[model samples]
Target chain A: MLSLSSQFPILVAIAPLMTAPICALFRGKAAPWAITTIASAFAFYISLQLLLTVASSGPISYELGGWAPPWGIEYVVDLLSGFMLVLISGVSTGVLLFARESITKEVPTSQLGLFFAAYLLALTGMLGICITGDAFNVFVFLEIMSLSSYALIAMGERTDRRALTAAFQYLIIGTVGATFYLIGVGLIYMMTGTLNIADIAARFPEIEGTRPILAAVGFIVIGLAIKLALFPFHVWLPNGYTYAPSIITAFFAGTATKVSVYLLIRYIFTVFGVDYSFEGLELTDILLPLAVLGFLSMSAVAIYQSNLKRLLAYSSVAQIGYIILGLALANETGLTASIVHIFNHAIVKTGLFLSVGCMFFVVGSTYLKDLEGIGRRMPITTFGFVLGGLGLIGVPLTPGFISKWYLVVAALEKGSVIGYGIVALLMISSLLAVIYIWRVVEVAYFREMPEGTVKEEAPISLLVPTWLFILGSFYFGIETSFNVGIAKAAAAFLMGGA
Target chain B: MSFGFFNYWVFIILLMIGLYTVMSRSNLVKKMIGLSLFQISVFLFYISMGKVSGGTAPIVVDGPLDTAAPIYSNPLPHVLILTAIVVGIATTALGLSLVVRIRESFGTIDEEEILEMKDGA
Candidate 1:
């Protein structure tokens, strides 16, 4: 028998990918979804086991197709990638559980199998990107991820025609970002003659200041920032999220950008060391201002949006700014804070978007006016949204509070007035969260049930997953050992220069 | 840095033209073609990077482990570009398919007109 530990890394990616075609071949309503659930569940289970293996054995490096590293592709599952694999697969399984009903409503039945297959493809792309240790392989998987996402977003046309425009705009922007990244990787490969990430990091110090290396860093960061929707490059995100099917929006909101952030972290700290990528270039100086502007301005933009999903999309951008803020600190504490927020934000955003999806299912619209008195009808979902909203607002004993505490602590550790100023910014951004979230709360709770609406809740299938995610946020909020331990080790490994 | 970098100069010019077309053109099909052009230039850059001035092919024609080191082109860049080429084609196919669907819905493929309809809604 093949040992699970040895095959764990590749299996995590291959399981879902191999199953996707099988799903596409299925014709029935339940078969495709059943296969998706089983495939993703298996991937998630393997990811959990792989994370355990890493925690015990340090890191697992597997040579693919029996070829060794620096010459052939390798799959390296360190603490960080292991952490991300678990989160990505875990959220995928969660979103798949909630996807059945929403997907049926939003996508045409003839294309149902193909749609789930595309979701599995997107999942495979993300997991493969996290697991692979080669830089060029990352680009290949990035395109796979981008292409499938464009397909999935376009499938939203049955519900709304704007889905086509959204997918088109997203394709244009996403292709540019990927092309920029290709240029960066081509430059690096030209200079280094290798594609393995660890091998590149080992060689980065020797040719630290070359013009090509500088340009490579610039190109790679800008490209990834575009993908991650950071600051001015975020034009493609709101429409993409708002117009896509709710399941697609939630999954992307929860996992996609976080993976991009993880990729940014990996490239910055691993492929190019901090001494070269951060200090040699004074990256913190550039990132600090952009991050601040992103969170503050986006949060303010979020408050006036009438569409609930679009509002949440803006807030997601601002929250991403918080993750980058932790990176801009360029210290272990800050890095720890950033990684921890990855977990926290994934849980909270998935829950929030899933809850909104439930609202969309029941009321047939996600507009604010349409939600006037949904709270009284869908009490469970409203309560779940309230929990997720409190997490967003950083209520004590919520996971959001923990991330904010670490961010503030990291800033105070800087021991400068600028750090103090950032703390104030974090506080003000959370207040903005309060205004937006409360607008929904007030509209849901205080207003009379819109004239003639029925009394009902989302199906138990959707409710189960939404509640699990909401409960997960509170569970992690109340307990820190499991998450903080992994985050700190990953942060320390990164701080020691990958 | 020298006259030997002629292919690279051509690659850069083609890339700029492609990017300019992508940015300036409103027609959806035209934009996908611009993306293909941009990606094709990248393919050229990779192919050119693999060249060795006097080298013929990367095939081991002198038998494995011959005494004389053969002047063969680097095979790795060729392999990398092949994969990238496949990706570029997949992107083009998907982009065109999306454009087809987009034209079906919007009645036109112009980005500005699509947005005007969106706003009018």
Candidate 2:
């Protein structure tokens, strides 16, 4: 028999993919949840192992069907992909733990199997995207992820009819985004005569500065920007996140757009190289201003949202701006900040959304008025939200602080007026985050509990997963070696490769 | 311009039409049709990229005699487009089904009407 370690790359994706249909076939209530959780746990374990292996032994390239690269599809697990795999699978497994109890409340019993099925398929798609080494394969896996998410979001129709419209809107926007990406890839393939990412990168030196390549870069950047929800193209994100089922919101809040960010980073740093993207094409000129505007504007918008879910959704778009801002910095430290924030933000946001899910479980609503004095009723869950909010505000002793610290240092490395200006923008954005997060804090703690409402907490199943993420973010914050070290190494690798 | 560039011109025109329809039209069904058209335009673009002038389909006959191998078109793009076509069909089906559900709940598939209802609600 082939050694299990030898197949870790494919196993990370196949574990969920193979189980999704089985989960769907089992129409029972508990079985589908059990199967999904087990599959996600298996994938998470493999991803952790793969990350450790890659960190120790260096990047591993697995040729599918025993065929070599540039001819057959390959799966490459370097430090970045490994770190993302762990983040995606770990968050998925954590979210699945809460899904059993939370999903039952929102989704009908008859649909639970199908819901988990879609969840696994989405997981498969995400893992596939992270693992694949081919450009076209990324698009296929992207559609898989997008289609499954569209269906999963629509499943929220039982809770709110707007979910239908929201999913429909996302479908249109997301498909257009994916198609744009396809057009870019096709143009690149036409020029380079290869689909493999490494092969394309190798061919770029000979065909540099060509018009078709320039057009391809524009198409790819715009497509990924839409997927990344970097301010202007974020029209579909808030509503989709707000109306999706609580568990889905929590799960996707952690994974979906982050995967798109991963793809964008791969294209920018790995496939196209930094010089071509930043210096030749001057992508930084465009991304820097947009990133600054995105965070400032989206954070301001978040401050006025009365619906807590919608508020957090807007906050998510703002946070994506922070990640993009790091990319725009075009320094190793800045890239490290972006990579680390992807992990940090995913954990903290998932935790905050899970806390909201918990409140929804008890209060049956996520509006600020419904959450009044929630701190007194569900203190553990509300406390989790407060800590997560502090993280968003970049308070010391939080993961957000680490990301912002690195971002500031990276900006100062420029030692120019523009850099200092960006530093100021970052600070202002953090303050805006504080304002929006404090809105929830005020309503939860300062306001009195509605009369005759008893002090009932969300069930233990939900609270445990919520606190796990909350506490995990703090643990990562204090023990920066895991997140920061991997991020720095990945950044150095990308810089060296370029 | 040579006729060799004709396919790309068709691609640009179809792409613009498809994108404009998806953006301008409020009917969800029409939007799906537009999406299909957009996807089909890309498929045509890919197929055109694979075309080898004066070459035949990429198939090998049993007659393996002393004759030189015949020129054949690049089959990879065709295979890639097949997968994209499958994805396109799936997207269209999903989009149409969502429109049906929207019609069922909101009583109309017009984007403006749905938004008006949402606002009223």
- Tens-place lDDT per residue, model 1, A147-246, is 9999998887877888888888888889888888988898898898889999998888887789888888888999999999999889889998988999
A322: Cα error in model 1, Å = 0.5
* Runs of candidate 1 exceeding 4 Å displacement: B63-67, B118-121
Q: For all the candidates, what are their Cα RMSDs to the real structure? A: 1.4, 1.2
TM-score of each candidate structure, all chains considered together: 0.98, 0.99
DockQ value for model 2: 0.64
TM-score of 1: 0.98
Top DockQ model = 2
lDDT of each residue in A1-498, candidate 2, tens digit only: 699899999998888989998888888679999999999999999999999899899999999999999999999999999999999999999999998889988999998898999999999999999999999999999999999999999998988899999999999999999999999999999999999999999999788789889889888999999987888999999999998999899989999999999998998998889998888888889998888899999999999999999999999999999899898889999999999999999999999999999999999988999889999999999999999999889999999999999999999987789999999989999989989988888999999999999999999999999999999999998899999999999999998886
What's the residue-level lDDT of A288 in candidate 1?
83
Best by lDDT: 2
Pairs of residues clashing in candidate 2: none
